[model samples]
Target chain A: MKSEVNTVNNNISSLAQAKPLASPAVQIDFLNSDDLIKFETKLESSALYPLVSSDIDIFQVNLGKMCNQVCKHCHVDAGPDRKEIMTKETMQLCLDALDSCNISTVDLTGGAPEMNPNFRWFIEELSQRGKHIIVRCNLTIILANNKYHDLPDFFAKHKVEVVSSLPHFSAKRTDSQRGKGVFEKSIEALQMLNAIGYGKADSELRLNLVYNPSGAFLPDDQKGLENEFKRRLKNNFDIDFNELFAITNLPISRFLEYLVDTEKYEDYMQELIDAYNPEAAKGVMCRNTISIGWDGFLYDCDFNQMLDLKVNTASQHIRDFNAEDLHSREIIVNQHCFGCTAGSGSSCGGTTT
Target chain B: MDNSYYDPKDLKKFGNITEWQPKLGEKFFDYYGEVFKEGALTAREKSLIALAVSHAVHCPYCIDAYTSDSLKKGADEEQMMEAIHVAAAIKSGAVLVHGVQMMNKADDITM
Candidate 1:
């Protein structure tokens, strides 16, 4: 039950409340440093300058910013102390929007989406709509409290695709990026998920694990990492998972703070820029995913939502849902966008390529 | 130019060696690439081997490159460390085994 202090809780003057960091302007300024090439310029070279949406097929909803763990590289800066959450009213607005659109997949993220009081209710609503639901579970939350202990069962009941972050299978690596004892709890949570139909060879219940690098490096090949994760987890713990999503940690929020503090910002950004793949760029997730904030604000993607960069369309909120406007509007690109386009490219689902 | 002998940035320019010597550079790169492909040893195993050899040769660039490579290939920290330890043992053993030569020389001189 040991709770790691967050940037807000630590009262580190620069990172206090994470509000200044949350300001899109401030983050944009940081991204626009003199040395780095503009992400837009790179996209332009690849004939992707005005990155537009193909289809708004996925709705990545940030349910809240409250979580039991404070992961070092969390772009959301979500933690237990944060109170911002999507009210049932907002959930209803989202539901109304979903009804109006053809968006078939609903991806729920947060400090832990389950921390939202109306989480189950919102899922129940989405379930009834027959929308494919993906919950970005932190895994530790399932073991964090008594109320959350049955989360696996609840997820299985809804046939929710459970995507949990387990940065590394080893305790030291996982605990370092996440929190101490996080790996142990996550293993227990995975085992629980396995005991049910989730991750079984014969089961439809999809249980995917996410592996972002523990540091500033880009993620390796998805298939290779997945094979390794599968072999190690199966042999070591007898655990089963459907897939491993090798995500690259975007430079923003807490991860931005880390890169700057370690004097690795320029190097990491350069690394991202150098490793930029045009093929990967074409498949960037922002083109297909519209991220909705807790308060109903919309953005191009989850990283954009954290930076407070709303989508360019006039339909800026769930209540003002306009599929046509959203689809036509040019997606926002910043230096942080390099993260998603680097190497294999990263998305909430996994590598785009 | 940087005063130091090594610059991490140079690693990215490694492919550019072909600009000066295209044939040899291309051949070397092709050979290197083909050597690391999945063979009797998994690509993951090759990456670990490369990491250990990177350490043994004390090449900072290779060490940096292969450490990230090994991790990307899903080689965990323990396995990586163990590979390095194997390199360390061989390196030390190479030096220690030469002590037998010293013993032989001393015996010849003294006798």
Candidate 2:
């Protein structure tokens, strides 16, 4: 009877908090539900439900680390500050790896991968081979250069799966992480992509949003957050996308700096360790997705690539790219593994679960 | 917005969580060491859960670490394998338990 009274009180308080009656656009803040089940209920019903995915087979190429913005959590130290760019010969090495590996997909990434002069040429080659092409875009880069002006239509034409970053739906949060005015430019770039049918729900040209956490903490539940993101973004910015990928920020480079600066190094480490749900150990991205750096060196994943932790095999570079060699190759990992095991695991592709 | 407490994206400043909090960092280091020992749930098992938790609680650091850990622990095969099955079971179970609320709602309607 006492419990029942408590439940009644909760219901009454909730009712009182329910829609201000003045605002129809929102019933309540989407993820404020103390009830996890309510959140999941919304997730299963979301339009951007992570399509059960296995890696699209392919040797992905890290074109370069020449980005336009300096995101706080970037493990690559990628920014206008980074000068490393992929060479044409290195690009050719990628093609060679693709040919040797018979990879069906060819993922292209970088600081602002579009900044690579050969970016278009490489995509054109991949498209010619009828490979599923994936391009990681910073989004703002599209507007940063005239040469990139038609990236949306170009991506659509080639049917490239464009995974672009938009850290948060709100301008304030986004700008804080990615630099001033970047949010506006990202939105514009997204609109351009949408106009070309890149992110339309049913369109073949896929445009997915990439989310990195602004601070040291892990991202929220992807399904619930994605639903809220879809709703808020669709309603607020007139933007449309197929999915929102919640990627983890690895502890390396600038982020490592953040850890030290914030003195969150220990707690964050403990969080991952304490939250080390053994379940995440099985399906991490690096297990299936092999990362190739700009110079054709093979690493288990992009973070490994940055740490210069090349795959432990006789054949390291793309020129020596071999599926048989990689078949049982031990992926190199260290203390950072806690990050992935700590939460719903994160990876280059996004959240593991 | 980025700390352990609360992040009101609804509010502009997620609050100034001073640049450093040494205590949490120390705590993390100690637990991290404990979690990594052999048979301490093995980093591999933790990886799969970390991935799922990445989706659950949403920490990017945990996600990155586990993704790498899972792969390193001879988890090179497609994650769609048995390990993924485990995560699927847990994640689905987690979501489904909340269905009790929906059932309660239905029960309320009936009564």
Candidate 3:
């Protein structure tokens, strides 16, 4: 026999002759093929969980969908070019919801939200009503144009809790998920908010930064990632804030388009289904928060609002807001729900945990 | 597609990424690394949190990374499955809770 070298060489040659099993890009179809039936079953059966809820009062103010940027993951399909802006009538209805219901917290969201012509006015009205207001701002929007140049002062003035999207502290990754130049402006805007004492530990201004992944991945750890975001922004760009919220991007609108375009749909969905955490399930945001569509239609969250899944209640639009009637109403759900409960749970605010 | 982001077509010019800014890419790389490491929380803990958040934000890349991460870091199949269920609960709950507004709207209509 020859030597051990000859034997090893023969084995290596045979190994090279074999075909590859699958590439990482689309491995699900190749290896996880057997999961198709179970995947479909789970997808259809998301709401069978034990954590259903029916008590909530706040009427989240979805003022409009016209945002300054068309983020790749935006569910509302809102952007600067959008002509559909919230009307004064819708604003009034939101205020009415605050006044009529025992709703104490009013979550205000929109495209850039600050880009809304009546955004400040709406905040003023809600503040006047002594409601806990949360304005979801795309940080970059605060500094992108002169019209919104004064947003920091405006938010702080109303004592509004600002939930701004940062995605990442680094520019390239952030810009990759958002558009070009967005990361820099976001950092700058965050700095402005920090200067105004929004995210500071003891500050009451309450500037919470939101982070979604740059690609089709889960957001990294929230507390640690927040510390890092705080450290980096503080070191690199001199920005500061209170908390760093790590949010999972909902698979709808532009993000759904991205998944289909990049061919990451099935694997990603399977990953979510495979990684469902029961602890995460208990903290799901939909149970506590209400999302209103731009047109006053109701949705469980912004993602469903984008998919046009209005509440399945007798009153679906803003023209009919009654806290008690909704207290016992059953929520309508579909496959997209798996996206929410798949992991730690996601919401407009961030991780439910 | 013609944006300034790292397009794969431009993978060959990895050296040129820093031409625009000398240390930005590597800096991002470092921060990116630090973010994914074990924390006061273990890697397993971090992975589970990431997995849960992936559903909340709904990033497929995140779902892919955290699924593998959780499994590798000792998350059993059931544990992982349970995490997604948590997300489902919150998501559906979020959708259903808004029914309050609808109920209020309906109450105003009927009552």
Q: Judge the docking of candidate 2 as incorrect, acceptable, medium or high.
A: incorrect
Q: For residues A1-353, what per-residue lDDT tens digits would candidate 3 score against the true structure?
A: 11232222221211132313112212223324444434335533554443344667445767776766766666666665565677888888877776777878888887767767887888888888888888888887777778888888988888989998877665665666577798878877877888878888788899888877765666545676676677777887777788777777665655655665577767667666666655566566676667787778877667667666677678887779777766655555544555666666666666776
* Reference-based lDDT, residue B24, model 2: 71
lDDT of 2 by residue, A79-188 (tens): 66456799988888777767776668777888778888888888998898889999989999889989889988888889999998888877776876677799899999
iRMS (Å) per candidate: 1.4, 13.2, 7.9
* Model with the higher TM-score, candidate 1 or 2: 1
Per-model lDDT = 0.87, 0.67, 0.68
Name the DockQ score for candidate 2.
Answer: 0.02
Pitting candidate 1 against candidate 3, the one with the higher lDDT is 1
Q: What is the lDDT of residue B86 in candidate 1?
A: 93
Per-residue alpha-carbon lDDT of candidate 1 for residues A1-353, written as tens digits (9 for 90 to 100): 22233333431222346456656578888788667789989999999889888788899999988888878888877777778899999999999999998899999999789999999999999999999999999998998889999999999889999999999989998988888899999999999999998999899999999999988788887888888889899999999999999899998988887787677789899889999999989998888888999999999998888888889886698899878778767998788999988988888878887
> In model 1, how well does chain A match by TM-score?
0.95
Candidate with the larger TM-score of 2 and 3: 3
Q: Stretches of candidate 1 above 4 Å error?
A: A1-22, B1-20, B96-111
Candidate 1, residues B7-82, lDDT tens digits: the string is 9989988999999999999999999999998889889899999999999999999999998888777788899999
Clashing pairs in 1: none
Expressed as tens digits, the lDDT of each residue in B32-100 for candidate 3 is 679877767767667887899898887765776677677444354566778888989999999999999
